[model samples]
Target: MFAIVRRHPANIAWIALNVALLIVVAGLLVAGSRVSVTGYYSEAAWNWMAGQSMYDTTGTGFLYLPHSAIAYIPFAVQAHPQGDVAWRIISLILFVLGCYRFFRLSPQKSEFFNLSAGFVALLLCADCMRNGQATVIMTATMLLAIDAIRRENWHLCTWLLMLGFAVKPLSIVLILLVGALYAPMRWRLGVGIIVLALVPFAFQSPDYVWQQYEEFGLCLFHSNRIGYEKWWAQLFGMLKAFGLEVPDSIQTASRLLCAVGTLAICFVLKQKLDSKRFLVWLYTLTAIYLMLFNPRTENCTYCVLGPALGLFYAEALCGRRWFAAGSMMALAVVILGSFELGQHITPQGVPPVWLAPLACCFFTLYAAFRLTSELNRLEPPPSREAQPVLE
Candidate 1:
């Protein structure tokens, strides 16, 4: 191991940087559990073990499924600081490993690209790590599932998708999008769904499990209805900052329409591109949609798009698209600076919470144009008559 570390000095430095950041953030949380979202997970697990309802009727409490609480039991059973540190360490490892695997999926591989992209993603997500948000793990699972799909490892893909959904229900966007676009995933998705549903019953009484499921649906419903009242860092917030207030009904309709549009784009691309490129495009679209449309999207939620952006940046550099690469770097800077930017008042007289969404909007348009140009440039295969005969 020492010899290997000496051979790859850059890799060692990168890993050390991640560990240093994790230690700083996790150390802070050890003393103040109030700031970290892991408190919610711990509370939910405690409640489940005590036969109490995990769902918050007011739409502000624990938002994940009961099975998710079960997943947190190990951490919940431990005392503060220790459990918090353990959870952060696990989250950091999953995220770093997932990013490494996903970056390797790029058609062109370079150590510099991998290290730079991974570092940028980590910097952009530092706040999420400090807050102990489950979004970090959910993002990791999404990256791993995409890599699994590219490799045609359907069994692993199914488990990863299920784990993502259990961590954050919003992951349904990626789950459904991938299932619809890939034929091989259909049956595996069905089996995974069944297993996820049945797992809760095995641990708890059927009556209790069924009741929690019912409350889970209601919890989501209430959350969606009230989500607009807060100052979100999503499309609605971006619009409202400009004096255009969207009603709750319009918000719901817009989300549905965009979901359909995403599926249509994926279907078209699946036929035009190779399997690997198509998977990357699918993940990109899913990540963008989640950031812009998820009703409760917060600034920290932008972590979901960090890995996708990193992949795009590396692709631009490999293909010699200097302009595109520069744009990606600029977007990363904006995202890293968004919290600071939000401190100053904008021309609209509101804090610039809209900065991240605006960047996402530009990225969406740029990605569409790039995809269209690539498709137009693709050369068609020659027919047999047009090809020269071989001796």
Candidate 2:
């Protein structure tokens, strides 16, 4: 079935055209002067350059690592409206760079599949740019890290992963995922990331850096109450939103279930850790885990799932028919969940129903189940025909 897609180059071009149209339509929807989460980063950089404490900034707290504030200084120096536009443009570039890196690492046999997968991913994540969030940059660094690992560039991978963690501490788990995949290189990766992370702060003010780190920790602890509802707060949040009572023990139950499930999956795929298929599966699962298990995940944060889904769909089309079907179902779940159609699921009565909580939760479990099943299958994946020699 997919051979027809591979034979025709025009299909790839059509996919590219649709991607451009989606971007244009979404851009029109968000073309106003609304200040997004990125405004806080820009404001923090300006404050830090003025010798004011980043933690003391009024609007949204400068919750990221001190290095992020230092890096944003260039964007901050730009005058008013231009800085905002420049930051968005830079972020969009980073997003495209990340997509390009992923394709380079996993060069598929079918351009149609690759281009279409990426188009679907971009369509799903257009809002990340609209909101001027940092997820796109963090996601791009993650792709770079994956590409570095594929090429066995240990130092570059460590540096990219550390930059991601510096931008958003939740990405520390992704660092751990990298360690698990390349166990032998873990020590070198760990040391390089930590050293690079601290250099910016050490050069500035050691005492002030210490203070800001402490404040950052405290801010994270209380972030759930900051008013804006997270898109992926998991089962407990969903249950509470549906007006069901949740006990303190629900937290313990949730952790135990996740731990048990993770262990079972490891047991099943324990022998395939070194295979290319396992690597792709692990990458997708890790990204999905970040979305599902994080304490606070906004709609913008879900953009990280883009590459993961694209990888899954591309692989599935390469002869794993069941896997391909599962990937399409997961994609549908993601889009349905994104519609904000179930706001009645919230404690406060709001309009624009948001089903993300339910849909994301279902899709997360579904992907894990499908991955485990794929790992346990006895037959090897299908092989492709080699390209013919030119006459």
TM-score for every candidate vs. truth? 0.91, 0.78
Report clash pairs, candidate 1.
none
lDDT of 1 by residue, 1-391 (tens): 1321344666777778898997788668755656788888999999888888898777887989887899899999998888888888898889988888777767777666776677768876887888888888999999999999988899999999999998888889999988998789999999999999899898888898899999989988888777788767789988988778998888889999999999998999899888878887888899899999998887888888888888888788778899998998898888777768866757645757788888888888888887888788786766667768799
Task: List candidate 2 segments past 4 Å from native.
Answer: 1-31, 56-60, 103-108, 224-233, 256-270, 315-340, 343-354, 379-391
Best by lDDT: 1
Please provide, for model 2 over 1-391, each residue's C-alpha lDDT reduced to its tens digit, 9 standing for 90 to 100.
2332344574557345545644553454356546466667887777666656677422146678777787777777877556656666676666666765675444465565566556655655676766667777888888778777777788888888888877777677667756765775699777977696577675567776777667666766556444234324455555555666456466556655774565456545646654445555555666666666565665556678777666556656655577554656565455535545344344465332234545556667667677667656866868998989999
Candidate 1 — which residues are off by over 4 angstroms?
A: 1-6, 31-33, 318-320, 347-352, 380-391
Best by TM-score: 1
Q: How many backbone clashes does candidate 2 have?
A: 8
